[model samples]
Structures are given as structure tokens and as C-alpha cells.
Target: MAVLNEEQEMLRDMARDWATNKSPVTEFRKVRAAGEPQAFDKGAWNTMAEMGWAGVIIPEAYGGSDFGWLSMGLIVEELGKTLTASPLVASTIAASAIILGGSEDQKSTWLPRLASGELVATLAVDEGPRHAPHSCSTSVSGGKLSGTKAFVQEAHGADLFVVAAKDGLYLVEKGDGVTLSTRKLTDQRSHAEVTFDGTPADSLAGGGESLLDDVLDRARILTACEMLGMAQQVFDTTLDYLKQRVQFNQVLATFQALQHRMADLFGDLAMMRSAVEGGLQALDSGFGVARAATIAKSEANRVLHTMSREGIQLHGGIGMTDEYDIGFYLKRARVLEASWGSSAYLRDRFAKLGGY
Candidate 1:
């Protein structure tokens, strides 16, 4: 088990308190009801930036806190508790790509802005729904990109886009032949079907197909950390509910059958935590990040899928109603499961890792 240091623990506690007090479930409810992706409270976003969360994983030279991947995961978990809707994950993935493969000039221009939250960026890699990075059909020619990227999270509000095209990785600004058509997704945040019609773009010099693979690997692990947080929160919330909600003259938590179920959930959560921590360490150590990320993400997906459904099922009637906050976690779990790569997709990748 990877135990956090004092500083990391403090950071996690601070994030937990902030998310609880400032961006609670009620806030998410308001944002979802408003039918706006930008409905994420601007004040909260600014606060997160000020707290240095936006720059948690970016290097210090780029105006970031440089807290490393584990620190980044701690904050992400807290955000999941509130079902906070924002471009944090998308921006982090984009920033990591730029740092890992972009030219020095590219880093100088974008990293600081991204770290400071002055610009929101998202990576466009999914051409269809299969989560295959190599299957990208978006083409680049003469420094221009053309194709449509579907299910782009926060695309409606992003200021910069790090797009993956067939020729290589390209950076597309938010205008000039770039059309972003916002699509209302089930999770109720902003997603878009982006059409690039010969959009002017800047290629990431020296970044080829390997860059896409690198980004996907990092993305998978980062997303797994976030999912770990979400799963933990759902488990904790469900456990709390069982303690208080009485049935048959006793709390539901007292029943041996329910106790056994919670015990099983505890075991799964522990496994997920270990896997995600290992994946994060592997990424930081420059180990086999792709395989480790696939394992972590695949396991986390199974854990969250089971926990989310079980959370609602255990809660009985209140779980199905929007009046309760548990449903929000369930909805967010489904969305996160489909993001980056689905469990089915990751399992295939894991098999490839094992040479099966």
C-alpha cells in the first residue's frame, strides 16, 4: 500500500473540506438542472485555481505547484465526491501531453497558461466510440486539420485543443474553421461534436504516433485515480446510509447479510486503491505505464460499476430518486467509466500486455 506523506495528506484533507463546503452535491444539482456545462460555478473554479489545484501536476517552471501524480489523484478524489463538473481532468491530460512530447517553445507558450487556469484545454482523440487511439481518421495536411471529434468533454468551453490527427499530434486554437457543436450528454455537462474544417494547427514537433500512445497511457491512469476516488466516496456514502437508515427495528448496517455485502465492497475498494496507487507510482517511475494503467483502469472500472449499482440497490427507494445524492454518484460513475477507455477496451489492452 502506498501511504501518502504529511504534505500529501494535508493536501487531500484540504481538498476534501473545500469540495464538501464549497461545491457540495447541491451545487452539482444546480449545475445539472441549469442545463449548462459552464454552469460549474465560476467562483469555485477560480478558487480551485487559486488553491493551485489546476497546476498540481504541471512543473513548477510552468507556474504550477508540481505536486506530482499522487497529489493530483488526491485532489481528483475529493472533486468526485461533489460530482464537480469541470475540465480539470481534460486539462490535466492535455498539459501532460504538452510536457511529455511538445517542443520547448510549445511548452513555453501553453504550459504556464494552462497551469494558471488562464486557458482550458482538452485532448481530442476519439473519432468514434471504440476508444481506439490508432483508429483516428482525422487528417492533417499543410498544417491544417480536418475531421470531426465526437464526445469531446468541455469542448464548448475550451480555449485550446490538443488534437490527435492521422499525420501526428496537432494543436488547434479555438477559432478559424473550427466548429464546436455542443451536445447535451446524459451527465448534463458540456460535450461537443467538433468539426474541424481545415482548421489552422500547429504540429507538436517530433511528436508522432508514440505521442498519442503516451497520452493515452497517462490519461488512462489519471482517470483511474479519479475513479478510485469516486468509488471510495460512493462506498463511504452507502456505508453511512446503512448505519442510519433503520429497518425492522434495527439499522440496516446490523444485518449480517448487509454486513457481508459491505465487507465484499470493502475488499474491492481496497484492491482498487492498491491498483491505482501502483499505477500512479509506475507512471511517475517511467515504468510500464501503459500496461499498468490498463490494469488499474480496468480494475477501477469493475469496482465502480459494481459499487455504483450496489450503492443504489442498497439504498432501496431513495437511490432511484433524483431527490437523493446517491443517484448523482451513480450517473457520474457511468460517465467516468466510458471516459478515456471503457473496461471492455482496457481488458483487450491488458490481454495484449500479457501477450495473450
Candidate 2:
């Protein structure tokens, strides 16, 4: 496990308590059952806002605690354990772009609203079937933007969008010329395809490919933290089941073969934790962030892919059923694995960054 300071520990404990008790996986199941339009629990989101969790990384000047990236990662990890569906991660990453590239006026306008959770925000990148950032062909002309952004997280409720264009990143609102079509994710979370037709937009001053890369690196690190959470949760649940589940008049946990499999999982979990912690440390220290993030996400993607598959197989026939919560973890793992960049994409990116 990674070392946590007093503050990070407090934040993590608070988030874990709320996620596990107040809004557990059952709560998420209820949201899916009702087919919530936003695809997340609104009351729970409001509760998180009230807890100041929506702005963990924002500066105090922007109505945030300015707790830094690790603090935010800790919160994300806890929420991931229960598959808590919220806009915190998306909004935080969007705010990061403005903080890094926005003009004084733009920062003053958007940061406070985002920090207060008064406005939900998201990033719209990736226009293709694969995770190709350079393949962005979106155009901006005469202050009007025309493009299509696929698989945008939390787009259903996002009040603002940070769109990637050929020249730079632009800020577009949820108004005229902007249309959103939902793409139902395997995990039942919200992801949308957004189309803009000559939509009026304001350029984020100083924003360019480099700034976009930095923002994405930070987002990747955060995603790794969340995956670490999910992996741990699945392992714990599986281990408990093995201890109690009887097969052939013997507890599965006592079988040597099953024990070895779980032991390997435990080892992999440790390595995943190290990668995630290293990525957080890199971001916090302002060094090697891109490389650290790539390594972390790639390792996490690999670990979760294995854990999700093994978790289902260990659960026997019930694991494949929708009635079982274990299956949801596998579905979410697949979505997240492909979201920012798959393991293959990240490895290639790392190689290119290393001039290989």
C-alpha cells in the first residue's frame, strides 16, 4: 500500500465510508434499474459536492481546497471500489485544462463554477475508433467549431466542454449547434457522442497540443488510481467467497490450485499499487509525469484484465450472470481499459516518448 499523509488518509476514509455505506453498489444498481437519464445518482453527486470532493485539486482561490493530485487520486480510488458513478473525475480533469492554459478571465469564470459543482464539465477528444489523439481532424473557423467527439464521459450532464481541435483546445457550452447522443456503456455509466455544427466557441488561451498532453497525462494517472481500487475490491470479494464456498465437500480456499491463482493475484495487486503510487508521486513532484502515467495505466489495464477474467471464472457459472455484481466489475474494467488508451496504445506511446 502507498503511504498516505494525514489529510489524504482522512479524505480516503471519508470517501470509503460514504461510498460503501451511503451509496454502495446496490445504490448504483437502483440507478440502472430506473434508467436514470444522467446515468448516475444525482443525490449522491450533490452529497459529494457538499463534502468538497468535487474540487479536491482546485486552488483555494477557486473555492477549492487545493489538496493536490494525490488527494484527488485517493478519493477516486475509494469511489472506484464501489463503482460510484459521479462526474468528479471528469470535472476535475476539465478544470485542470483551464488552470494550465486558460486566460485570467477564463480561469476566473470557469474554475469557481467547476469547483463548486455548480457546473459539470468534460473533455471531448478522440474522434476515431481507436485512441489516436493526433488523428483529431476537428476544425475551428471564425470562432465556430465543427466536429464529432466520441465516448465522452459524463456528457449527459456536463454544462461545459473542453474540445480538442486541430489548432488548439476550445471551450464550448451546452447550447445551440451542440447535440449529444448517448452511447450506453457496458457498465451502465454515461458516455456520449457529441456533435457540434458551427458552434460558437472561445479559444482557451495558451492551450495547444502540449497542454492537452499534460491534461491527459494527469487524467491517465487518475484513471489508474481508480482501477487499482476496483482490482482490490474484486480480489477481496473473491477471496472471501473462496473461503466460504464449498466444492466437492471442500472449501475452495483450501485447494492448492485455487490458492496459487489467488496468490498470484495478490502479487499483481501489489505491483499495480506501486505503479499507481509512482504515477501519483511523479505528478505531485512535477517530473516524468507522462512516462509515469503511461506506465501506471498500462500496468493497471493488464492487471484488471486478468483479475476481471479470473474473478468470473472463480465464481463459477454465477459470475457470468447479470444477477451477480461480480460481472459488473468485468464490464467496467473493459470500458476503462479502452477509455483513455488501451494497454497496447500506452505501450506504443511510452516507446515513442522514449525515442525508441
| Candidate 2 local distance difference test against the native | 0.90
Report clash pairs, candidate 1.
none
Clashes of 1: 0
Instruction: Report the alpha-carbon TM-score of model 1 versus the true structure.
Output: 0.97
Top candidate by TM-score: 2
- Report the C-alpha lDDT of model 1 over 1-356, residue by residue, as the tens digit: 68889999999999999988988888888777777655476677778888888899898988998889888888887888778877788899999889887888999999999898888899898888657677888998887789999888888778899898887788899988988877775677878889999999988866555888888887888788778878888999999999999999999999999999999999999999988888888877888888888888889889999999999999998898978888877777787788878988888878887999
Deviation (Å) of 128 in candidate 2: 1.7
Q: Write the per-residue lDDT of candidate 2 for residues 31-91, one digit (tens) a residue.
A: 8898865788888888899899888888898888999888899989999999988889899
TM-score of 2: 0.98
Off by over 4 Å in 2: none
lDDT of 1: 0.86
Off by over 4 Å in 1: none
